[model samples]
Target: MRLPKDPTPIRTIEVVPYDPAWPAQFEAIAAPIRAKLSPLALGVEHVGSTSVPGLTAKPIIDLDVVISSRLQLPEVVSKLTELGYVHEGNLGIPGREAFMWPDGNGRHHLYVCSVNTPNLHYHLLFRDYLRQHPDKALEYGQLKEKLAKQYPGDMDGYSEGKQDLISRLMQEAEALSGFALHQP
Candidate 1:
């Protein structure tokens, strides 16, 4: 039998009710990366639905390793690679670089982003908004659940379905945050 070369290919879009352990899971994934990178990584953030209490989401954890500038990327990538994660370039998002573990390091989406990146801002904005607004989180969770069921095994469709709600929520979040976040 042949196996796919990509180690952590997300083949399906499975959204489930929030698990309380998600924060600990993010820590498990973050700790070592933090230890190794230390001063190089400004912060290893827990972003996406799993970061918000009671928000339904895919089991995957999303983390952003922040750096001061793209100048830090080479060392960041090297250190992460040493930790067994393969650098997957930007994966189309310019300011963020993606990395994936080769084994069962638990499912996660890891990105290295400079402090000024639009991608990083969006991730933080979305997570913070959901964390503070339970009502909005509930709405997002319901939408995600419906989309997950409607687009089983269809990641593209599931992601596409989230655009409208996410955009609206981001706008509200930016406005309430007293700043405007541009979409990338």
Candidate 2:
């Protein structure tokens, strides 16, 4: 039996070796958002594989715009819009909100989550754990490389594939950090 080639254009997924400049890039992206949202935004945190030193990633920076409470969500959304980010309304994640990046700056993912959001804790814990354990980070990097090749062009497929490992690592991260996931 012959399988037909799918007509959908495969979006290129490029997983590259960890770049030392990722931290600086994060800082650059965070600075303005930090400045614009001052007092409202608790902090713009760098997470994801890019934030983990020496971890292979898709090169797209991931950030969390933390707020003190959900009461601040409206204001945060308004200000981020002024900063050139269009709010994407949590994208099915309850506590966190996603955004489209501004034109003319490098590509990145921006998320907003209040202090008690589990998503926020997940990202921080996973990134911090990977930073502390280089061996595990390397293992994660290898996994990402393999998955990128296996699921190239299917972004959803790529993300779904990493869930099992992500879940395991999240558990390890939570245990090590002693931080329990909580809802807002």
Candidate 3:
């Protein structure tokens, strides 16, 4: 698979104070996605680290839009491209598709998937879990900062570092929110 142009190789992760701008930024991006995909989309949600307030992130927003089928991918890609997104295959993660918005600021990571796709929902559930629970969010933030430091320049390594923590947190979220969790 071709690597994404802007690889976020780790450097010290810092859970900076919550930026109130995140929600508005998400809405701005979501509006276009919703409009373009409405006929094909089941729902659109803000996922990933940026979606959680008081959480430090890689400064890139992550959005997920649930569509009906894998066959619908081409259309989704075309539509998103028309709106300035550059398609990027999941590279390694299957059952999920990714895209990068060509914003000079390097703003977002967008994904499209099926409604029945558990991984998509799991990401949303995790985001919601962190949002609703401040302590956990803080803990995750610290973990990220540490992982960033340890895995600097290693994007794959950085992601692997968080796998265990994410798994355990997903369990807590499932129990507390009753959202079904998908093991990736």
Q: Which candidate should be chosen as best, given TM-score against the real structure?
A: 1
lDDT of 2 by residue, 1-184 (tens): 9999988766788999999999999999999999999999888899988999899999899999999999988998999899888887879888899998766245799999998888898888888899999998998889889989998888888889888888788777777777866322
Q: Score every model by TM-score.
A: 0.92, 0.89, 0.82
Stretch of 10 with least lDDT, candidate 1: 3-12
C-alpha lDDT of all candidate models, in order: 0.91, 0.88, 0.82
Which 10-residue window of candidate 3 scores lowest in summed lDDT?
8-17
lDDT of 3 by residue, 1-184 (tens): 9867766543554445568898898899899899988798887888888889899788777888899898888999899888888888975777788887686445677888777777787887898889899999998888888878887777777889898998889899998887666544
The segments of candidate 3 whose C-alpha lies over 4 angstroms from its true place after superposition are 1-15, 103-105, 182-184
* Candidate 1 error regions (>4 Å): 1-10
Residue 18 lDDT in model 2? 94
- lDDT tens digits, residue span 105-143, model 1: 558999999999988988988899899999999999999
Candidates sorted on lDDT, descending:
1, 2, 3
